[model samples]
Target: MLSIAITGANSGIGLRAAQALATAGHHVLALCRDPDRGRAALADINAHATHPAGLIEADLSIPDSIKAAADQITHTVGHLDVLINNAAVFDQTVREPRFTADGHELFWATNHLGPFLLTAHLSPLLAAADRPRVINVASKGLLSMPRIRIRFDQLDDPSWYTPTRAYYHAKLAQVMTTLSLAEKAEGHLETTCVRVPAVRLDPDRVAAMPRLLRTLYAPKNRMAVPAERLGETYARLATRAGSLPGPYVDENLRPVRAPASAYDRAARERLWSLSQTATGDPAWAW
Candidate 1:
């Protein structure tokens, strides 16, 4: 059975993917930030799960936590066949320039840098596998932002921000960054970016609103559904014929050109260099 490591497995798409993987009998390491939530999620999945599972506590927004979690995964799991960069943050509705303790742009920290560092530190483990895959959950939102250029100074002085901008920026970075990694790996490893549609699937968030409103508006829930229904695509990247490398995929598992700007090789490199600086771990060598 393939050994898989998934971040943000406590809820949303991560949780669903973990569940699907467990039922299919692959060992799943559910990485979460909260121990309590981790244990509960573990229990929920374990009750009827086809495969055994374990939990590793790691807060995506914290660099130190990510490092500790990576160390623990390396020590315990030995290596992984699949690494799903699934954790994310979109809690605010307004433009807000935020930062983690490490002083990274908030969305960039959780959605981009956290996964980049985790992949960097854990790449050896992934490389050790026969045919490994790195699946990054990206979004179609990259199309909306007319102004997206990774400013190295954004780390130094994050100017006015918005929830819309942050979410779009975070996801866009994932797409571009994944492309960069694919280029760097030179096909040594299979890396694919899945462009999920916008969705919501939250209990409280949905219950508070009118049924028609929920159906017509958010439609997904506290978590997004259409964006997530294709969680299987992530599993496909590992378990099925979805192993095509270096392409941004759509909900139907087809390749898509996310945005003309996302293909900028120079910007991709700048983002990579800045990521190396923020995370303190150099990008992996093929």
Candidate 2:
């Protein structure tokens, strides 16, 4: 069975992907931020899956936690067939400029830098697999941003930040990073970014939002694809044989040509270099 690990597996797309893979009889590692929640998710997956699923507690927003999770995976699984960097946060209403333990902006750190470091740390394990693939979950919201560009200086600038802007920048970074990884891996590993369609939020989570924000999101969520459909797409990327998908793909697993800016070689290289600076890990390679 293919061994797969999914971050943010306690809920949403990650959880559903783990369940789908487990049901398909692949060995699944469901990584969650909370131990209790991870175990609960594992139990739910076990109930539906023919093959057993497991849990690993990991807070991707923190580098130390990511390293610890990687260490545990190496000790336990040895090799990973697929790694889905699916965990992300969209706290649009968080008015204050929050920072991660790493001192980076919360959205940027969680959505981009965390995955970059996690993938870097886990590269060796991924290489050990026969057909390793890295799948990054992205969003279409990026297209709506006006003149969207990677402003390294503005990443943590709360003055000009909005929840949507920060999130778009982070996802754009992810897309570019995926391209770099695909180029670096070449024949060794397959890396792809997916622009997953919006999925409805858990009601409790939505209820916690401001009434206006909740109302704004409710109709959009209603139009979103169910978690199960998105999960199936994620599993297909992992389990399917033959040629790998393009460097960028959509929710349907079809290849997508990322925007022209994302293909800029200079910007891409600069972003990688800045990532190294942010993480303070010169030896880390995508």
Candidate 3:
């Protein structure tokens, strides 16, 4: 069985994916930020799993926390065959831009730099595995914003900040980085960016929303795909043998063309360089 690690596994897509992977008999490591929630998720995952699941508490927004969690994973599971960078912060209700302790914008730090650094830290363990895979996540919502580009000059600037803009900008960075890593890996490992569509929210979360907000979201919620279905796609990406269809794919594992910006080699290289500087330049295995 493959050894897999999934970030933000305490709920939603990450939680369901962890359960599905563990049930499939793979050794699953569910990385969560909150210890209490991590343990709770562990119980639920273990209840349905053939192979017991493990938890490593990690706050991806903090570099130190990510490093500590990586160290823990190194001790707990000697090597990891798959690393799923699934954790993200996308609260549409957030009005003003928030900054981390390190002064970077919250969404850019948590959604992009966190995964980039985590992958770098775990590269050695990944390289040790027979077929190492790094799975990055994107959004199908990006299709609507066909001309969006990574605002390198104003990534952390608050003047142009909005919740939706911040989220998709970071996702676009993820997609570009996926292509960059795949090229630089030089056959040492494989990288793919999953273009996730709108996932249905849990009933409890929906019910808790304010009445007007709930009413506004009701139509979209009804059209959203079930979380379990996307979770299964994550499982397949982690475990499926042989070549993937492409670097960017839909939930069905079919190739989906990435944005024109993702193909700009110069831009991708610049992003890679910027990410390395942001994350303190962790040594990559490939």
lDDT of 2 by residue, 30-104 (tens): 889989878988998888787788788888788889889888888988788899999998887777778986678
lDDT of 1 by residue, 103-196 (tens): 7777878888889988998898888888888999887777666567655565546564776677777788888888898888887888888888
Clash number for candidate 3: 0
Is candidate 1 or 3 superior in lDDT?
Answer: 3
Which model scores highest in TM-score?
3
Task: For candidate 3, give the lDDT.
Answer: 0.93
How high is the lDDT of residue 56 in model 3?
95
Model 2 spans with C-alpha error above 4 angstroms: 282-286
What local distance difference test score does each model get? 0.78, 0.85, 0.93
lDDT of 2: 0.85
Worst 10 residues of 1 by lDDT: 219-228
TM-score of 3: 0.98
- 1-286 per-residue lDDT for model 3 (tens digits): 9999999999889999999999989999999998998999899999979989989989989999999989999998878899999999988778899999988999999999999999999999999999999999999999999999999899899999999999999999999999999899998888899999999987877887788888999999999999999999999999988877789999999999999999999999999999999889899988
